[model samples]
Target: MITKEDRERVAGWFAGRLPKQWQSAPAEITIDREEITVRLTIPDVDLPKDASDAARAEARVGRAKAFREETRKQRMEIAREAEHRYDAKVSWGLALGDHTELWTHIAAPVMTRLRQPQRMVLDTLVDAGVARSRADALAWCVRLVGQHEDDWLVELREAMASVADVRAKGPATR
Candidate 1:
């Protein structure tokens, strides 16, 4: 359970540690239990005002790829330092114009025991070809719920944080 202060501190650390020229804007840092993802927005490619949409799109992708390759060594060094300090794996991404790409992120497996009704839901997704297997179906379902209920989930997380704060303030059990 990461506190709000912990999140802010991590963000601040990245803001100061990252090279100024690397990001056109502040880095977007997302932290979970096992990973910390840092997404930086690179400056848009300078193209002619009358450039075609396809050309612009291609340039954006090229720019992001170049950035990734050029900074791979330096990024690895930074990620190693961050991972050591934070005790979590570090993932990197880039956002160029309207394009975003995440590379070298983890796909951690989760285990669960589902009841018959829950199993049926996943089976339905697999049977309908929405996913390749029950595991994929469960992931798909979670993603779908997240997309639709993001606001509610955020509120719930905030409430949980408040509960953690209250618990911390109470008398020590130990």
Candidate 2:
């Protein structure tokens, strides 16, 4: 928002820059400081579209531009920072130990698919504190291997082992 002083300064400055032809033109200008509104209207349009009219228009635009420089720069910088933060691979998965949230999310559905035997195994581990936190719970449930036996856990371990073995023998011959 511009102050009344700024408004008068700009209006007077603009009026002074107009050509002589608009000297007698009745101009209505209102500057709403809070809204940063600058309204300029020539209540008397009887004057010719000579140098004064063009000059006055130019001056009004110039004043507005000058006053808006800081705002424009701030807006552009904010937009640039937002773009910098967005990436396709935004480290969405666990890094050091952010797996806690992911576990809770997966658990809601996995509990329904478990067989009775698997459920008991999971319950025992969960009770024995094998799953220290959500992350640990998810690790025990999905990735624990040898010595982590309990049919379901064993199957998961074997599945992961198979994947590792496959990866080890890269580009296998047909």
Task: Give the per-residue lDDT digits (tens) of candidate 2, residues 47-162.
Answer: 34564856655554544444335334543443244225321111111111111111101222232465778667767777888875444555566655534567776476557656
Lowest-sum lDDT 10-residue window in model 1 = 2-11
**Clashes by residue pair, model 2:** none
RMSD of each: 1.4, 29.0
In order of appearance, the predictions have TM-scores of: 0.93, 0.22
Give the 10-residue window scoring lowest on summed lDDT in candidate 2.
88-97
User: lDDT winner among the candidates?
Assistant: 1
Report the C-alpha lDDT of model 1 over 35-152, residue by residue, as the tens digit.
9999999899999999999999999999999999999999999999999999999999999889999989998889899999999999999999999999999989999999999999
Prediction 1 global C-alpha lDDT:
0.93
Candidate 1, backbone clash total: 0
